[model samples]
Target: MPHNTIRTARCAALVGPYLAGKTTLLESLLFAAGAISRKGSVRDGNSVGDSAPEAKARKMSTEVNAASFEYLGERWSILDCPGSVELACESQNALMAADLAVVVAEAAPDKAVLLAPLFKFLDDRRIPHILFINKIDTLGDQSVRAVVSAYQEVSTRKLVLRAVPMREKGVVTGLVDLVSERAWRFNPHKPSNPVSLPDALKTDESEARQALLESIADFDDALLEKLLEDMAPDSDAVYDSLAQELANDQIVPVFFGSAENDNGVRRLLKALRHEGPEVAVTAARVDAPAQGAVAVQIVKTQIGSHAGKLSLARVWRGEVADGMILGGERVSGVFRLFGHEQTKIPTATAGDLVALGRLDKAATGDRLTDANGGKGNLGAPADWPERPAPVYGLALHAENRNDDVKLSSAIQKLTEEDPSLVLEQASDTGELVLWGQGDIHLRIAMDRLRGKFNVAVKGQAPQIPYQESIRKGTSHHARYKRQTGGHGQFADIQIDIRPLPRGSGIQFEDAVVGGSVPRQYIGSVEAGIRDAAARGPLGFPVVDFAVTLTGGQFHPVDSSDMAFKTAARQAIAEALPACEPVLLEPLLTVTIAVPSAFTPKIQRLVSGRRGQLMGFDARPGWPGWDEVKASLPQADMQDLIVELRSLSLGVGTYVWEFDRLQEAVGRAADRAVEIRREVLAAQ
Candidate 1:
């Protein structure tokens, strides 16, 4: 094959904290690669990466945007992922398809802690990544080295500075490449111009370069020997070592620039071109088959207005052509995306990220293959990051009755695009609940529902699941007599009611003797008792009680199943209130996981929410973290995640399950009963 036709294809993902300029960096990369003539601005809502209406309105990326371009004879696909912590799932999914990742970061050292989870995720997956310190122009009076050191503290891997800032009068105007020994000054809207090294900064540059060399030498015995011998290594050899070490996940190379002004972007691209692994290496790393067989993994799914359902997938193996049979479905179209715009393509090969149309059955993270549908392993490592627990939830309902019919379908599409968003139908409350990482996350989902799917919904706090049970026992006699046109209905029964132990559930027994009531009518009586148990006197499901049928009378002709059932229901309804009914609140064993620094705050938070702290200990496998075990009322957990994040810089998380049902007491219990009474009255 000719060199022009035989192109090298690779992909990289951009990820970082909120407002870290990841989208801007993507725009800069596109401009530098000549894919776009002018760079688009996030502030102006013209950036290609954030083309969705919700993203443009909020000025933040809500989903992953994939774009492919050619630079210097090489084909590249860049996945620009959302930076918001709530949207981090988008980044996680996109990372599985990339050969490398470019982690963008803010220049402030104090905010370096925000990158803790992201760094841990990268390190845990052993995914090779490099750091891009963005917005360097805003680092007023802050030392870049200090920022680098702060980042190093969070990252488990060694952080190697690839360049040193060229500061003149305490302002960084350029950078000196440590490997190539070249200096370049930033030129806004144009490529950085090469400049001679300044004599004033020679000593600092040399020290920074020496530190970089030492960090690399730690992983290479030959490089260490050369360094110990006081020998200068060749520039090509140094670059090769850096690339090799980075690809091996042994060191993280750091670069700095302002993506808004397009500074240092070309240099970043050059580094990627030289160091990033090819598709073949990535395929092997994930254990994908070497032979070129049709295999694709759907990374994302979106329902387009004009194009219909589009599944964004990375072709992991053989060529995927339009109308090809894949996983029992025919591909409708193959499109290569340029931000929001897509161009129809005849075929896509290995390492190409393209959108396949009309694959309604294909969901995000689905591994698809040819008609055989064999050996499509998604290429995700065993420990791929799981979706974060929902920190916020809202009970949602359609604003218009007509939309209610379409609500479920719309939500399905929304979750199909973002697996992070969870939709639940509350079993007790019967409310449609939408759970997500935060308010912003849910808001974006709602926007997508309304804007894209034309579903407008009303949202409110989710309802707590509260139950009612009897505290005491009572016995009563009841009779049901009705006169009809021909046959009169008559039934009588005597029953004993008692409270059982918590979690024992409802129990029914027939202690009748001598056929006081026929065996057949006894079943009707039991059924009636159970039907009435669905709602106790306190307007909630009743549990932990027992009912015994002691005796009953039935007229042979006048008595029917309905009469016996009515008598049994009437007996329980009259006796339950007199039995000292009490409200039963759900108790959950909550294990609060957070950094040790915020353990005390978490304790206070639990106490304030009427929770009992059982104990606390170091969280297993997570250093400097603690898990506080507490028994908390279900009512207090509605906003726990919101408060937890506010206290722990968004790193705190917890797991909880129903432990038992405990009797609610004090004014809280009284308030709950009163509110439930009002709700029942309204219904």
Candidate 2:
């Protein structure tokens, strides 16, 4: 029976690892809802989610995409999030606004490990999710139970299988709903056809139904009592328990489907319509206001060259009207987004995820309220997903120097859309470095630079910020006596140089007596020595050394700041070569979080990269995972994330910070110095 009346909109975020068929499932879901005439394929570059040129070029989602549809008189807005691990934060932002989440996964048992991070995040947040084992047609005689059991290892929430597969010889032909115990055969691109239960599956279905009942009974005392008394609980009672437990995020319902063929999509939609939590439940979960106060949380922001600033937000309470004053910024337009198409709406209420036009001051994760007392009132939740730390960086240069201003503006807009991107001007390297989660992430940004912003740019590995320090030091006396004109330059200085402890930095002092050097000229001598330290004999910043002026002579007529400064620099220049200056590279204290099974591989990878292992322990609050701490050289840490993900099934991640500097004394040091010299020559 279909609902006869229209209802309010609900939002769901489709999330999973890369290649999990989320985009394909989006197409099928829209087709089943009669929102689209035909399904678009991701490979064909025609899918609604692949509207961006960057996404189409790679045939993968580069960012969060929004789609809306109506089914059975109930409207829905689906947030189609990127699946790559590098873009996990993008999914987190969208999930914060959704009423529920559909965790799509491939039906491969070995790939279950890939869900650990996402499962931990969802479980930690108590977000209600359904595990949909997609591409079941590719199961290849493997039972869905195996896949479910594999996933159960990673998820803390109880997983309740909703259906049991029915196979013909070795191939799955249909499935039986555990609650209804009704068999239905799949019809491609259409509704499943009901069929009588096969005799062979009767016992299987009975066992599965009992399991489902028992799982839900754990949360319902009445159901538990009925089961204990050998009484068969009604299907309605089972469904009610399932809905209640799911709303409370106590369990994860499991379903299987081949979304590419449009099989089982209707059942998923029906389940959502019947079991999904209301906007009130989500509002309470996120601590949204209880009253009719207008508030919206900006989950994602998209800045278009033509569309201008579009803030995709969820209306958590009250109604937001076009031209309403929110946080002192007038909402220019209220739009319901469908990929690239935006339909102008007069208003949006709670649970509606729409794009607001021209809220320039608004940013992602801002909760805008109607508290406009002439001052903006945008509150950000503490649980707002922290932007992932940059694990990769590239020195970005405009292909045409004339486009430098445009490049920076475009990059700023890109950062607004994806907060994970970080732009920095390196003090040591003097390069405009852009930091991100990985190379692919930075590549996507570069693509958008050329494709979306029409700004030409190029990228390369950023230069390492390496410093040079002295192991030994000696003193030298320098004299600047240039008799070029009537005013001849004449200054002499005797300085004692000695290496201080590491991290002591470059220091300068004077111990001259008898006022041999004028008081004003002493400051110039110190400045010149500091300036000389900026570019040492090794062509890098010098550190952990000190210089003291023992005695000096000067001609008052010509010995100005410039003469003293020149003589001080000359003294240091002559003293540095004999001081045994050594190359020093920065080391980072890295803490890597990964499944325990990959800890050994991580250790080996670190060891291969000149990393010294500190220790490893179970990750706090995350079961079955380990946090491995190590000290790695900054030069070797560049591609560590890339290799770590390759070794850990794409789930390994780490945080790193500068710990200290270490002396380099091998071929690696020589190679680094060689590269530095070459780079300097080029410049």
Most accurate candidate by lDDT:
2
Best by TM-score: 2
542-582 in candidate 1: lDDT tens per residue?
89999999997989899999999999888888889998888
Question: Pairing residues by index, what is the TM-score of model 2?
Answer: 0.98
TM-score of each: 0.96, 0.98
Clashing pairs in 1: none
Off by over 4 Å in 1: 1-6, 290-292, 371-384
lDDT of 1: 0.87
**Residue 403 local lDDT, model 2:** 97
- RMSD of every candidate to native, in Å, equals 2.1, 1.8
